[model samples]
Target: MSDKRVPSMTPPNKAYPREELEEMMQKWLAANVEAEKAGDWPTYLGPMYTEDAVYSWNIGPNEDFVAEGRSEICDIALGFQMHGFEEWEYPYHDIIIDEKRGTVIGFWKQLAPYRRKDGSRFEIAGIGGSWFEYAGNYQWHWQRDFFDFGNAKDCFFQLAGAGALEPVVKKKIHQQAKGALLPGHRKLREEPSRWEKARNAMAMVKIAMTGR
Candidate 1:
């Protein structure tokens, strides 16, 4: 991994009003719908982030991804990370917005572009969600995603076993298995885990219940 540091999650210098945030989030969602329809995530979704925005997600216990700045977020995160998933469907099921905090959470599912032998869609077995920190002007300053890594792995294995995995995706999987670090990825200990917030919340709940 490069010695380059991840950007800090500093609060914006100014707070956006609740009304403005609500409107901005709605506009963002509408634009996202168009982007998904067009199948051009980098072109449509990249511009909707602040110049210095950060986007991150956890792959598993040993690795995590972090793309700092809009350029990396677009080229690497949105572009390269989606190489084999171009035709896949990731429809959002629900969205929750916190106007006061200027944040939004979107729940979605990962479905293969093609159906299985049984005539059913091949879907990952767990729900995926993203937490976005709104930056005024219908843009996001930060984003962190949550999902079941194990379920994703299992789904890919199932696809491979069924001879449904794409050639490019198989290559990607082999490359990743070789231990070469992909761009924007770091060892878990080097970069903060994306699950930190969730784990903290769980800890809080446990403490509250047990008075520990």
Candidate 2:
């Protein structure tokens, strides 16, 4: 098999300089966030992945949507932008750096136009893994499977799951879920499949156990 870097969790004992690793990581997250803010997804992915990059979405639930390569991935990403989907980005939060395997994983939040509907937004959280190779410094050979966030409700549960307040601070979500006539908010995930609903529901249940 042709040797290529893959995302892994193998810890490093003594590896490359810390400064060098941080630079590549900053480049990875910065470019991603820049594209997200500017809606320039094509430019966002072009630098970090190869043409034949293997990627996917919703590794846990809602696994139907999938893509490969820069073009295919950007097509899905830009589709959301063209449709006015918005997100909350945290480029520097909870980042774990491993120089041995040359990978970085961090937490992210995205709130955007729903896939099945327009003008309505939902939220999700994901972890990005970037595997790199040395070109005098680290250059990403490929970044794949940039996914694993749950649905809008799931994101809320994620925050709550992380020791945040459990009370549904915003009444807008349940309003939207029930398809109520609310201004500035619309029903997006009104009727999700059994699995889709289960993931977020169970996640929220865990939040209640956290003593809110």
Candidate closest to the true structure, highest lDDT: 1
Per-model TM against the reference: 0.81, 0.46
Worst 10 residues of 2 by lDDT: 1-10
Point out where model 2 deviates above 4 Å.
1-18, 59-64, 77-83, 86-91, 111-212
Q: For candidate 2, write residues 43-124 as lDDT tens digits.
A: 6656465555433333333222334455655565334322333333434456666776555555554543333235343445
Q: Each candidate: how many clashes? A: 0, 2
Count of backbone collisions within predicted model 2: 2
Candidate 1 lands at a TM-score of 0.81
RMSD of each: 7.5, 12.1
lDDT (CA) per prediction: 0.81, 0.48
Give the poorly placed runs of model 1, Cα more than 4 Å off.
3-15, 190-212
Q: Residues 6-80, candidate 1, lDDT per residue (tens digit)?
A: 566554545568787778767767776776777778888898899999999988876778998899999999988
